[model samples]
Each structure stands twice: as structure tokens, then as C-alpha cells.
Target: MCYQLVERFSACRCLYFQHAVDPCEAYRQRGHSVQEKVVLVGYTCSRHSMRWSGNKARDSTLSDSGYSSIKG
Candidate 1:
């Protein structure tokens, strides 16, 4: 059996909202803001549903003779 599983990734949740800092000089310099959105700086996953990024070999149940032996 092929132990190969596709890696799944999640979107950023913290960037769901937009805000403007009052003390930010750059914002004031523009006279008006371009209404810029927050660029996602990191990644996240819903660890609440399924266990994520755990030890593969140790937690895996697949047989040792599987194709995973040929680690490319």
C-alpha cells in the first residue's frame, strides 16, 4: 500500500479583519488610506478536528515493507 499522503495546509485566520493604526505616520502621510489588507505572514491548521504535523513513522500504522522504504 502506498503510504504517500498529500500534505494539507490551511489559511490564515488572524488576517480575517482589517484595521488602521491611529499613530501610524505612513497612514496619515497618504492623506487617505488605500484600505490595504493584512498580508498573511504565517500558516495555520484546524488542530481541533484532526491531529496535525505529528511524527509520521512513529504514528503511522502502515507496514514497514511498504513503498515508503524507498525514501527519495
Candidate 2:
């Protein structure tokens, strides 16, 4: 329900931001034990109108892991 004209930045590290714009609640997709856990994380830049995701096992969120947001 967020109608704010948000701006997206390449360096911006915000996952909940995607949820603000998208209909489906975008959450950190987590993995399982045997194959190692994976958290689906991404960033959205409204100003640039660009959305990018670090779909790698290493790319983790601030809340998910100790590392910072993925910047690429």
C-alpha cells in the first residue's frame, strides 16, 4: 500500500523497499541445511527505476548475516 514515489540507488541497501512497491511481499528467501541456507535478497532504486539482486549464497542481508548488503 505504499504509493510513495521512491527512488532506487545502485548503492542503496534496502530489501523492504521492494516490498513497498511490489504487490507480493518480497522477503529474504532462505535455504535449507543440507544444501546450505540461501537468503533471497535484492535492492531497488526508484530514482533509477532499477532493481538488482545478489542471488548468490554469499550475498546476505544485514539482518540475515553479519555482512552488509550486496552492492553490485
Which number leads on TM-score?
1
- Model 1 C-alpha lDDT per residue in residues 51-70, reported as the tens digit of each score: 34655432322222222312
lDDT (0-100) at residue 51 of candidate 1? Answer: 39
Q: Which stretches of candidate 2 lie over 4 Å from their true place?
A: 1-4, 7-57, 64-72
List the lowest-lDDT window of 10 residues for candidate 1: 1-10
- How many clashes does each candidate structure show, in the order listed? 0, 7
Give the lowest summed-lDDT range of ten residues in model 2.
31-40
Off by over 4 Å in 1: 1-10, 15-36, 45-72
Report lDDT (CA) for all predictions: 0.34, 0.34
Count clashing residue pairs in model 2.
7
- TM values, all candidates: 0.22, 0.15
After the best TM-score superposition of candidate 1, give how far the Cα of residue 23 lies from its true spot, in angstroms.
7.0
**Whole-model lDDT, candidate 1?**
0.34
